[model samples]
Target: MTRAKSGKSGKSGKSSRKSSISEKPSITADSSTAAKPSITSKSSSDKPWPYAAGYDNTPEVLEPAPLTVKGTIPPWLEGALYRSGPGYEIQKGGRVSYRSRYTSNDLRERYKKAEAITGVTFCQRDPCKTAFQKFFTTFKMAAFGGPKMGGTDTNVAVIPTINFPGLMDDPDYKKKKGKAGPRNLVMTTDGNALQELDPITLEPLRLFSYGAIDDSLNASNLAPAHPCVDPDTNEYFTVLLTFGPTALYKVVRIRQSIKGPEYEPDLDVLAEITSPRPTYMHSFCMTKRYVVVCHWQCDFAASGVSVLWYGNAWESFKSHDPNVKASFYVVDRHQGRHVATFEADPYYAFHTINSFDDDGDIVLDIAAYKDHTVIGDYYIENLRNETGGKPPQQAMLRRYRLRNIAEQAALSYGKKGQPQPVPAQIDFQLDESVNFELPSINPSRYLRNYRYAYGVNRSGMNKTLIYDRIIKVDLDKIKSGAKHSSSATFWMEDQCTPSEPVFVPTPNSTEEDDGVLLSIVLDGRRRTGFMLILDAKTMKEIARAEMPEGTVAPHNFHGVYVPNSVAA
Candidate 1:
């Protein structure tokens, strides 16, 4: 980690232009020969600008530089805020290939069979190129244009630039069959690996697997994009989804510590739970004592089968089954045991807000959707007004209260001595009117009963999928059925979009909402980006960190704020 002293001081509400730093070479890849769909901006002046189209054209790598500040950065505010997402876009006719030096004969045979099934040839001349070529070929064929591939009309076949560092040199690399190697960064929807960037510069550093540095940590098949951090212990908790004869979910805890001069984090597997089917889960919930994994009816096997045949993971999804019930797998954080499996009404959720124990019952709040249409609706092409398609199903703020969590776990045995599922009641439409996603809360309130939840809401006459407003919800009042329970909303300029809001608590703050909400806002009309800082309490703009002219920050899904002490 690198540290630099703060520059000359500037007053609040005034723009300050800092001297630019010397440019450093950026890590970037160019593959424009692949078959990707072209995006053209709409010509009509009456319509809102197509922001999603530009999403795929942003720069792949950014250099470390000073950003212009519109207002004074809180003098006490000291930390590196990190954001992660797909920085590079696979444009039309863009070709990308990957190779691994440690490929085995068995993998070669499997690749041959997969190629035969999809009629796509893998680069056999270079074993190092085979894995990525096969992966990208399947991805493009399934997502771009192919018979039997659904949603090909949307043209949303963008591949995240996933970089794996130092795997080729590992002597044991070939021994790990079908296991994802250690990566410095993985920016995909499936969460195979994580990428660490310079917290201050947001420059690509390297890719790493979940347990890259810890030998005691068990390898995970897939990693979650959103990992919850415990405010008290500063330990990060996330789930790793694995599949074989049966699907298994493991909850892992990661903690950072100083080893001499470098920061080394240790990883530990907290608990592993079984799922009957392979489910596509994007996020999970963590409480003080339990880690909750929700298995929706949305199964990955339904799509994985197609990848086996057609070579695309996105092509494997089946329609949502209303009759199928969603299952909640709760694991005891301390004992690392499966405490209970509770069932609730069928629904699909991409993100979870918070979960905690309320009088022996587990309460989980999520952005619940009617079905899986939201998955396809996120395609950049699908958000165009010319598509004339109905808006994707909005995820309503829903809460599920599982009664007798401990009691059900104790009496889980059935009459036949088999474990039976527990029942839970769910409450939907707590506010009825507010529909949003990408939720966040103050880090200190994580794993505890939180009062306020912040998230992004979309609005405009065009009704596109762009996020136009940031909303803060009062959980207590909303649960009480009080009218106008929403605390506040910070609306952006027309056509300007904001990414997910991350809450950074003020130093030694006692109040829950006494923090700052940080988000990267993209001015689509101007084709530029900036960081928007808002007062968590009043939802008012405190400052804005403007990017250099012509620098565009691509849309990001999630971000984290590491305080100065932790960052150093």
Candidate 2:
């Protein structure tokens, strides 16, 4: 991955307007050995201004000790909250821009065609000249890229030549041989391995991989950040995208036996299916009977050679195809066979709420968007503080119903010869809303029909991408023609952004919403971070765990909560 540090001047690059920072006394571990730190420019105003503009540069591995709680910690809520994202920012030499290298030749051809079309020398006019100059300069620099000074590091170990056996033959790999090490570090989006942290102290404990922890399991593949756990069997399931002789999507299941005299856990591959193409996918859906791997229209290069030359996964994605149907590869959980391939209208989804088997018909709920514009809007440069452009279209809670066509075809069309298995038909269900994403459901209700769903909600009319409210949706009421679908909402104060809300179900709870929603909120204006706990039923604040002063928490993507008994 080509990591570059651009625009480190701490300016928004807009007007010369600066936001004032209020001074506060900083907290230190020991006063004897260290001086009393104050919230100075170094601690507050460094990096990008207007904290929500982008991520901060404080990428240290500090163990924040003695967190202060505003309210009492619930006795039943005893577990670790494991959160993961990009943590460290380190500057290294011999960096190469993958985007420039992959697109340089194509860009030159386009430029020459444009010149001939207009019958004018490039950069000879006013507007056209300016546009031509910009395009040429961008491509030229990309073709002859130089080393970047600063970049974020996740502290993940590079696999060297072990993961990619053909790295020696690749031309780009030859250039990066000794000049730079293999860029196999786990990233926020493309997480290669899972890092376990101390739940209470938020201290890094260890890294996890299929090959490292279990000798029986041998697979070198990237682990998706979001994985689903089966409520019935208590088995954890995730898909690993493998590339080599043939691109294979492997479904892995992790089972644990807690009742035996000696506790034992097993990891096994449930299914291995060939993927049609290589694309950047963050999450998938798993129902009670099957696992649905949706091949979203977000396409990377179709071949392994293109993927290797392209370098980064993000650059590999060329464009989003609106006409191509999103392909869903359904695999039976028990049999581990490719049951059917369902096609639906093209759309992109980052998170799925839940999936269930509704009377033999598969129903899946996800946060869907029309295109991939929302992703580019997440870049630090395009943030509201920098560009001040309108926020990307919000993702809505869209329900898709996949009807079993095989049964319908057998009855309607009749069996002429060997009856062909019908493809599952998909259609939209329920009215859409534009205020939801980063969805969460009660873990106990997973793989089964449930009533409620919780997620981060954006404040109405706010022009930024930060989520300012947490909302609870009554799925039953929404389906029944209720005018208002939201049952409750907990809106944070202005300038405070909330992370993905995690639902923790109460022990022996009967009601669906009998739980708590845990989220880490950053007060961009105050330069402080806190853990907000809310009542899942009413969306009311229960407690707030505030970190020590001078502690900066970077934005996190996903998190999981493990009960005390389970952690033990």
Candidate 3:
């Protein structure tokens, strides 16, 4: 086993900027290197931005190596902050460390022989180049039950076993029933397969499907990368899209405990939604009473059956239709039925911030885009381009209110062959200039009314690289009034791009912003990574935990912070 020796922490100089929130600080150099840290505002040069380093495949750090702590780590903060874009940082007893192992070793090897791979991936093209070759390969794979979905690259989001005793046998189930976060970490992608990992060592334990949880359901190809969890109920919710003669979207729910024997199938099919043309859904929203499943304008060609012919998800999507408005299917959680279907202007979104029941109305907040251009912009080749290829189209924080949902359902649903789509009111829209994505909020306020939201600002990053700063937005302030300058606060460093800022609340804190934001920042100049700790309220740097020597924590997507008791 490899062990990391404790190294001395370094301090950084405070920014001379007036506002505390948007300060650009510089890190002090360690004795090992004499390089001075500086910030860059322009990217006119033709050189490839170091930010592209994030796209490169990173080696696994399976051992728990101690990280060099630069400042005070909160005494109460202890546990594993599991990042599902493939890594995790464990902070306990004032010492910080990490272990990373993406469950795609086999997939990476296949990419080496790219043309030899058989699976259909989101952005990757089919190995069969020509028309005849594609037809032959797709026919063979679909006929022989070969891989169809984006298999085993479970690097999008990390879901913890918050509920579902059948998923894992926890000895202290009663004590931590609804009070804790995830006990066992599960890695998920935009596919059907779920990868289970040993929480401590980050080792791939087993590969299974939704069928494993319930025998009635077939392991569908398409599923939501981000599953919704009711923090209050401790129940988990996920939608499985099974494509066949008739495409069916089954919203499954798993509760805290099963009534029958241990490990017996515990999945409850909450609602089976039938759609002739199903749009691709990356994430969904869940409130106390309803689950909001929004299908954007990015519909699959031939009702998703063409995926077998094209053998590529992105290729299978029909061109965006401006006339087709995005639809939101509201499922009644308690009654296990579809309550109403609401429609908004055509848009695409990869992540939904939160949803809640406001009296009779179901309010939903999401990071939405105008079209599906954002999907192809993330191709590895474009990101690593010397001149920073095509600039990424940003997502605006949009709010859709399904007003008087019960009344709309009564008037429209079940009245005809297919119910007319109810118009969802556009309550609020964040400024078009502010580009936000990979949103995170206080988990406690997930299914309730919340004020603050943290995410990476990709506004002008195309010229430089990926996301260069972390942003905090006041949702209530935006709804009450509108000002891009006053409503949002940002924390940034020169040439240092941060990942998704995850808000970790202080224990027993009443204030929603009374917590710290944790993000893995890639310092482009030094070619290294560090765990950035920011004061959530003031948006100031609380501390920095530097990773082991030679380790660069590559850019990642969604992550979850597990408290000590549950993580252990």
Candidate 4:
């Protein structure tokens, strides 16, 4: 978590899964002919992209619909043939680079233009690109490490701390060669590291991957449940891991001999909680006695479905009985185990979780749906198979309280040893007629210390959204959020193009007054990513710092603005 002020920067945010568990050949091209490669036409040695489809098959046959999805994409929405979907969809589909061939070529070309204008920025954005690096935000985090999933050999394997969107080749680059796009996992010891392993055996083919980590730290395993750091001692602990649909709610803990480089644990499970439904968590929270979870329902074009999750209400998201609808839950730890539970089904789902300010309240964002049909696929089918569920009818942002969650829990399940969850006593007593609105939701304090919280919602061109805004109870303001929605009211606020905000020390400033909320925004233009500063109190924009073009947006995960403490 070191900061490289002006030149390049650091702070690692990571997530991953065992996609190949073995390295697939980087490209089908011959070594000598590797100099000039084209993504436009499929090659004999080139493997087709997954989002592009049928990776194991020849690229030609898959070509028929790579750019034209008649039935899948609507006629008006046909623009999707080449356009990207919401940020969450891109993350779920594991899309690091824009859609392959088209992206490869476009990126390279864009790089040249940005270079002529901004110079070197992201990874290799050119010298003048310094303004956009947001030197404070570059500290990239990596999930666990281990052998490559496909290609190379049949046996040799080695783990390398995986960094999502690793070493980006400026989005402006023109015609990027295969195996040469944004996103990657490299060796922790050196920047330019690789794992050329044997495909047959999950073993490394070289010595570059000696000191790597593994699946335990895998980010994609579930929510980026922010790791815990002891404020009194600067010691960092990785926690709140997810196993498919279940949240490993405070299951286990990791300890070490020293503070930084001297010790790196092989991530141990600290706590565990099962999601009732097959879910993928995005953000979660931890109280002294409970772990709050948010559910994820991404419409990765691959699956064509959207989702809504309430806390870690896993079982609720699933239509286990066909009579089920979406609901939220709270897992309570009275002594040392998951002692109690409660839930609510107001037909809503969650995407992010956080602490009210940095003091007490448990806060989260919920999405409301219109004419929603739920398709629940529990696992990843082959590329050719469309196993993903259907998305919600439409999504609207909502708000809720975590502290009040206890009463909700009391009314959600039966006693400790009960078989099926039953309505608790409290749920029957509360009046369901009043509407609650949040006045102003402040995330700067908690966000200042916690690097990855869904601080604001995005709503403008569309309806109302929380992705780009900060909402509170008593202040109704989602795009379509109404004062009479029968839910919590959220105060609408705006942030630059940044999501997943992190805290950093002031530029050239000392550590004592550090905790600043920092978010990077890629203007969706030819320029580099921009930095948006926010006040921790009101959760309002304080400044919109400009960075040069050709910069990179954070990959689809959370990041830490670690100061150059002992974390190196």
All candidates: TM-score = 0.71, 0.66, 0.82, 0.40
lDDT of 1 by residue, 79-160 (tens): 4443443221111222111111111122233434554323322112221221122222222231222332221111111122
Candidate 1 to truth, TM: 0.71
Top-down TM-score ranking: 3, 1, 2, 4
Model 4, span 349-425: residue lDDT tens:
32333333223334444343321232221111211132222211234444444344444445444544422333322
lDDT ranking of the models: 3, 1, 2, 4
Which numbered prediction scores highest in TM-score against the true structure? 3
* Each prediction's number of clashing residue pairs: 21, 0, 0, 115
Question: Who is ahead in TM-score, 1 or 4?
Answer: 1
Clashing pairs in 3: none
Candidate 3 lDDT score at position 381: 53
Provide the lowest-lDDT 10-residue window in model 2: 94-103
> Which ranges in model 3 have alpha carbons more than 4 Å from their true place?
1-48, 86-90, 109-116, 125-183, 244-246, 258-265, 412-418
Per-residue CA lDDT of model 3 for 156-210, tens digit only, reads 2334443233364444532433334444456565566565554444444455556
Once fitted onto the true fold, the runs of candidate 2 whose alpha carbons sit more than 4 angstroms away are 1-54, 59-64, 71-73, 85-223, 244-246, 256-268, 384-387, 405-433, 484-490
Candidate 1, superposed: residue stretches over 4 Å from native: 1-43, 46-53, 60-62, 85-192, 195-220, 234-236, 253-271, 302-305, 386-390, 413-418, 460-463, 484-488
What lDDT, from 0 to 1, does candidate 2 have?
0.50
lDDT of 3: 0.64
Taken over the whole model, the C-alpha lDDT of each candidate is: 0.53, 0.50, 0.64, 0.28
